[model samples]
Target: MFRRICLQLHWLIGISAGLVLAIMGLSGGMYSFSSELIQLIDPQITRVSPSNAAALSPAILLEKISQHSPYVSSLSLSDDPEQAARVGFMTPQADSGAKKFEQQYLNPYTAELLGKPASEDFFRVVLNLHRKLALDQGGKALTGAATLALLLLIISGMYLRWPTTKSLNWRSWLYLDWRLSGRDFLSRLHVVLATIAMLAYLVFALTSLSWSYEWYRKGLNALLGNDSATISKTANASRAASNQSPSKALDLAAVWTSFRTEVPHYQKLILLLPSGSASTVQILYLDKQAAHPYANNRMVFDAASGVLQTHERYADKSPSAKLMASLYALHSGSFFGSAGMLIMMLVALLMPVLAVTGWTMYLSRRR
Candidate 1:
């Protein structure tokens, strides 16, 4: 009876989510090695000369790019030291009045602008489509639904994999017969691979869902005591103080230098430039010597006065916050480096097989 219940749940979940899972799995598989693919497709963009004593300032780089296109939006620096620095700007469309945003590569050492890429650049388009679901409303919804379904599939899959029989045999648990018929062989392979891929699928699904669904994100935030109301109140208080009088301008470079000096052991530094009305610069540093990359330390600096706003070493984060942050790293397989990424790729590849095998099983049973 228990086995029968498990099979029914598994089949129902698989059938409902199969097509969406296949699409997400294939797209995710493509994105697994996107960094390498980007390098291979556009070697020039990835190339960077050694930084000289006269490295370009962020303000100067932004200023030069603003000359050609005045509608400057946001600028981001690549964390990868090997890659050329990038500045993005919003420019007025030539044919239409609408604004369009694009990224430009720069030589950090010389601050020289490189040639703009053609609109048809392969890797850029692929990553955009993969991330934003082809920039279509329907596509995004479909992907979101797929992510939710993936979560259900993982739950049902685990139930199915749980050992139900009293007698434990190697053949039943692990072995697949080479001499078996094609249908049987495929079924065994699908079940085994799905079992192995379950945890990865769950991590990817939850993270994607957190991005896609507001309720999930809010719920997660609430669980971590990071309620939206608290954030809003904090922002409002900060804004009120700023409105009272002009705040002192903060030196972003000095803030970064101070952070580095304070945390001398960190290997990588990521600074997120503030946008909209926000007045804080978030700095994240990765300690390579740490057991896990997700445990990297983080600090926030006041954009106006360069005063330390928040200092949250990964170890200091609330348990729930730490779990959520770790999920981000795990979903991308960066938590475990190259081996983890390769494992994730293999799991992604097996998803299609699982879907195909599931349908085959259904059809055979109906016959």
Candidate 2:
């Protein structure tokens, strides 16, 4: 009786939430390769011809950028000379809703503006569709609920597909019987493909829940022994301290020098410039030889005096801290490596297939 109830709930959820999950999955699959896609699609704007001379200092680059545009938020510099330096800005929209993020590339060697990458806007739309269905706050809540439903669907589907002791075998669970036609083929395909993609979907649902639900995020941080409140308080205190004095022009070259002195070798680095009254410049960088793509080392430097205030190396972090820091990488499957991301993308692409098959079977049953 309980199993029957579980089966019914699974069907109901699959029909109700399946479409949303499919959309999310499709968007996610596309976004997983966003960086590569952007570079490929807009190489002229995104890439640069390498020069033998050193790239312009951050100060000089910022000065040149400021001449064309104001309110620069962050600057990303890559050790790969072929990559253009990206400068980011957050501008308020006319509707006064969410701020729009704009990014422009600069020739690191010459400090010449290299108009925005065309693919950036496309991916931004894809990301918004995945996260919020492009409907803003209402969409966020719907996606969160759909994610919860997906978690339930995965669990119940696994339970329903569990084999008895005598029937337990790799072939029984994993093999797809293609000889069957119509409903039989779909049923086999749905269960077998879902079983194959189960772990990846679980990772997607679990990691994505943090973005959708505040309670889930807080609970996760708690589980990981992260004190979010304390971190918030510390940040507030830093901002408050910075607010005490009027904002002044920053000597970015000295701060960049201080950063280089602290960490001599890096693959790529992003300098988060201070905003408003804040005078603390934050630098996040990956070492030349790092554990993974997301293994970021952070340093906080005083914008005024160019003195290094604090440095936090990814290697020095505790296991939980490391896990917390790696949530994005884990979600994207880049934490496992390139092969993991490929697997993740494949699984994500399978969501629409699963949904279509499941719906077809359901309609056939009703008929």
Candidate 3:
């Protein structure tokens, strides 16, 4: 009776939440290779000719960018001599539908403006769909519910497919019986493919919920011993300090010099400038031999004096902190490497297959 109830719940959730899961999965799969895809579209903007001369200082690059946009929210510099620096800006929007954030590349050595990237807007839409179904708060809630339902579905489906002692065999569990017809074949194919992809789906459902629901995020944070309140307080303090101060200008040259002197080696360096009235500047960079793409060391500096206030090395972070930091890498499978990323992407793309097959079987049963 319990098994029957579980099977019924599994199909019910599969029919209802499965569509949303498929949408999420397909969007995620497309976005997995976003960087590679963008580079394929236009390589010149991001890539630069290697120059013998040292790259220009952050202040000079900012001065050059001032000709295009007066305010820069952030700057990304690459140690690879052949990569261009990226500058982010908060441009004024003409209307409600217009985009407010913008980014453009610069020749770090010559300070030449490299126009905005291609297909960024399209990718932005895809990202929005994955996160919130492009409907903002309401979509977030719906997606969160669906993600939670997906977790339950995975559990119930696994339970329903558990083999009895007599039927326990590699062929029964792993291989599809193509000889069977109608519903029997469908059942065999569905269970077999699902079993193959079960681990990947489990990872997706578990890691993705961290973004979809606030309660889930907080719970994960607590579980990982991340001090959310402390982080919030520090951010609030920075904003309050900015409001109390009269000047908003940052000494980019001094901060860059200080950073270079302290940590001279890095593959890529990103300086996050203060927006609005914020008085602190946060800089993040990856080591020459970073553990993963997301393993970034962080530093906070006073915008005016360029005085180093705080620094956090990725290596020095607590286990929980490191795990929390690595959530994105784990979710996208980049933590493992290029092969893992491709595998995860393929698995994501196959989500629609599962949904369609499940729906077909459900409808046929109903008839």
Residue-by-residue lDDT tens digits, candidate 2, 107-170 = 9999898998778999999999999999999999999999999899999999999985766899
TM agreement with the true structure for every prediction: 0.78, 0.94, 0.91
Residue 91: error of model 2 in Å? 4.2
Q: Which stretches of candidate 2 lie over 4 Å from their true place?
A: 91-100, 231-247
lDDT of 1 by residue, 1-367 (tens): 9768867877887888787677667767777887676666676765676654655655566456656655444444544556776555555568987756566667766667775544326656654565556767777777788787777777767777767788766566577677878678778877777776778888788777876787887787787777556645644553333222112354666665666567755555545555446677666577657546657565778776667877867777677766766765687786798898888877887777889999998888778
For all candidates in order, the CA lDDT equals 0.67, 0.86, 0.81
| Ten residues in sequence with the least summed lDDT for candidate 3 | 238-247
Worst 10 residues of 1 by lDDT: 239-248
At residue 158, give the lDDT of candidate 3.
84
Best by lDDT: 2
Per-residue lDDT of model 3, residues 145-254, tens digit only: 88888789879988888886676788867887668999878877788878888889888888888887667777887887889777557546544432231235778888
Estimate the overall C-alpha local distance difference test score of candidate 1: 0.67
Full ranking by lDDT: 2, 3, 1
Which residue segments of model 1 deviate by more than 4 Å?
51-54, 71-81, 92-100, 115-135, 222-312
Highest TM-score: give the candidate number. Answer: 2
Total backbone collisions, model 3: 0
